[model samples]
Every structure is written in structure tokens, then in C-alpha cells.
Target: MSPYSQEVLKYLNLGIESELQAYVFYKKVMEKINDEETLEAVRKLAEDEKHHFLQLEDEYDKSVRSEMWAPYRDIMRKEGLPDIDEHISETHKELLARVDKLKTKREIFEVALELEKEAYELFAGFYEKTDDEEAKKLFQFLMNFEKGHVLTVENMLKNL
Candidate 1:
């Protein structure tokens, strides 16, 4: 276990929320798209986000029970994990507000690329913040997953 398990757990919770936001955003985007290929890709991306959210939720539960860690709500508040819900909601809002700008399939792919890049960087930071091998492996796994997402969106943009 890392000395900063509490902080790591806080980040994991934030990641969980972020993944859910991504899933919702992608689903909404799918509604706006009529291209079969783009719709299929967006559906797949939403499914990936759902899977990531479930994985993060399981990880958080494991961390909570593993070491008799105290409830972290107050610690997270004091440490200012920066209010995950609020921060992610603002991001979601920004993405929605850009729908007009993203009328083209390529433009939508570009927005997805940006979002995946953000997730990749965030997970990499979480990996660096942890001292535990288990936590490191988990974050590394997530970082790689997000990196693949970045590549997928970038490639989609190129093809569009």
C-alpha cells in the first residue's frame, strides 16, 4: 500500500466520475451523428467508458477495504481533490457548448481526441503519485487504456 492511499483513492473516485461523464457525453454525441461508421465508433467508445467506470469503481472498493483506511470524504475535501463532479460537469458543459462548432464528423473526432489526451495525462499523473506497486499497476493500466483511446480518436480524425 502507498503512503498516499487516501489521495490515490480520491483520484480513483474522481476517475470513476469522469469516466461516467465520458460515457454520457459519447452517448449524447451518438444521437447527433447519422453516419453509420461514426455512430458505431461512438457507441464503442461509450461502451469503453462504461467498462472503465466499472473497473474504477471496483478498484475504489478494493482500496477502501484493503488497509482499514479511514473514510476519505473529509480528507478529500480538505485536500481539495478539486470537486470531481463540479470540474467534470464543467468540462461536459464545454463539450456540449461546442456542438455547433463540431458539426462535422472530423470536428467531433477532434474533440474526442482532446478528451482522451486529458484522460491519459490525468491517469499518468495518478500513476506517478502512487508508491504502491498495486496502485502503480492499476494506474499504469488505466493510463495505457486512455492512451489507446487517444490514438483511436486521432486515427478516426485522420480517416474522417
Candidate 2:
């Protein structure tokens, strides 16, 4: 892979892995989530993350055509980074190292909200830099969904 594609894949995979991990993490946290409305929102957002995982997995599978993230899986695996159900695995260990620190229900929701905001901002930055229409569309969608997530978290926090 060219250096640019490799770089894109490495960074993009980190965000992708983060999303999948959040999906799994939220599912487990949902069991202990006390706020009914927050619980329902988390459930829905968890599903959204799963769907994003599937889309990214499909993109990874097509890396042969794009060379975007082909090496990500190997690096993530050798370093013991969590790979959301294998296919959407993270290609790095730095973010994975902090995964276990989210121990409480509120922490899970708050951290997820923060992560989503970071991802949305990252994608928004890329959306402006690259002329790729497909990527722009994907990032735009992610931004909107993440914006909604922030509102959800605000409501949950207010009630708490």
C-alpha cells in the first residue's frame, strides 16, 4: 500500500475499532444502566454502532481494491488490541489499552459520547480535505448521528 493509504487506514481503523468496542461495551453496560430513557437510547445507539461496524467491515474486506487498511488487522492482533468481533477489529493498541477504564454505567455513556464527538470531528476534518464523495457522505452521516448522541447523553446526564 502507498504511504497515504496506509496512513489513512491506520487512523481510520482506530476510529472504527473504537466504535465497535463501544457497541460491545455499551451492550454490557446497558444491563446496569438505571435511567430508562438513557437505557433505551443506549440500546439504539449500540445498534447504530453495530451497523457502522458492518459497513466498515465491508470496506475492510474490499481493501484489496483500495489498500486502505489491509495491515491494520495484523498490527492490532499482534499487540492484543480488541477487534470488535474480529472483522471490524482495531489495527492499533493505544486506544485499546484504555478500554477497561470505563467501569461505571455513567462513564460508559459519557465516554461514548466523547468518543463519538471526537470521531465526528475527525471525519468532518477529513470530509473537507478529501474530494472523495463516498467518504464525505459517510463522514457527514456519522457527524449527524454523533450530534444526536451528544443530545442523548446530555439528557441522560441531566437526569442523573
Candidate 3:
């Protein structure tokens, strides 16, 4: 594989891993909670995360074989610095610690809200930094989806 494809795979795999983690986390939360409303909400979120993971997986599969992969460019503004890596798994690890301690529906929704916001920021930063049109579009799509999750979480919190 070309260096460009390798770089793309790195980011795509990170995205896939993050979504999978989110799916598992949400599913676990749904399983632990007895409140039907909260259980249903978390179940839907888990499904959404699963859907996103599949989409990214498909993208990664196609990207590895496609000619659309572009050469690496400095997406970050630092004159000679490397592209900023989205260590979403690390962020999830931190959130998972806090999530494990939550004891209420409100607390659960609050954490979900924060996680969605963080995801939106991460993707938005990538969208802004990348010069590659396709990367920018992909980042934008992820960012927008995360933004919707933020809205959904906020609505869930309000209803709680």
C-alpha cells in the first residue's frame, strides 16, 4: 500500500474503533439500566454508533483499493508539524471511567451529551485542517453526525 493509503487507513480505523467502543459502551449502559425510557434511548444510541462503525468500515475497505487516496499533506497549521491525531479511544477511556460511576438517568445523559460534543469538536478540527477535499468531506459528514448526536442527547437530557 502507498503511504497515503496507510495514513487514510490509520484515521479510518481510529474512527471505526471509536464508534465500536461507543456502541459497546452504550449497549452496556442500556443493559444495566432498568428504566424503560433510558434503556430505549441508550439502545437507539448504540444502534446509531453501530451504523456509523459500519459506514466507516465500508469507507476503509474502499479507500485501500481506490485511486482516490491522495498524498499526505500537513493538515495542521504548524509549519512542519504532523497532522493532529484524533485519539478518540483515549478520550473514550477517560469518559468510560466517569460513566462507570454514574448512577442516574440525568448523569447518563449528561455524559452522553459531553461525549457527543467532544466528537463533534474532534471531527470539526479535522475538517478544518485537511486540505484534501475528500478528507474534508468525510470529516464534515462525521462532524455533522456528531452534532446531531449532541442535539439528540440534549433533547434526551431535557426530557429527563
- Indicate which candidate wins on lDDT: 1
Q: Pick the candidate with the highest TM-score.
A: 1
Error of model 1, residue 51, in angstroms: 0.3
Candidate 1's residue-wise lDDT over 48-146, tens digit each?
876777677667766565422122222222321213344434656766577546667877787788778888888888888878788788789988889
What tens-digit string does per-residue lDDT give for candidate 2 at 27-139? 55666677687778778877777666656655545653554544443333332223344434343343444455656766776777776777677667766765656666766
For residue 158, model 2's alpha carbon misses the true position, in angstroms, by: 2.0
Model 2 RMSD, rounded to 1 decimal: 6.4
The 0-to-1 C-alpha lDDT of every candidate, in the order given, reads 0.70, 0.61, 0.66
- Best-to-worst order by TM-score is 1, 3, 2
Ten contiguous residues minimizing lDDT sum, candidate 1? 73-82
Question: Which portions of model 2 miss their true places by more than 4 Å?
Answer: 1-12, 65-105
Note each model's CA RMSD in angstroms: 7.8, 6.4, 10.8
The 10-residue segment of model 2 with minimum total lDDT is 74-83
Expressed as tens digits, the lDDT of each residue in 5-26 for candidate 3 is 4556677767766666666467
- Local lDDT at 86 for model 2: 41
Q: What is the Cα root-mean-square deviation between model 1 and the actual structure? A: 7.8
Q: Return the TM-score for candidate 2, rounded to 2 decimals.
A: 0.64
Q: Judged by TM-score relative to the true structure, which candidate is superior, 1 or 2?
A: 1
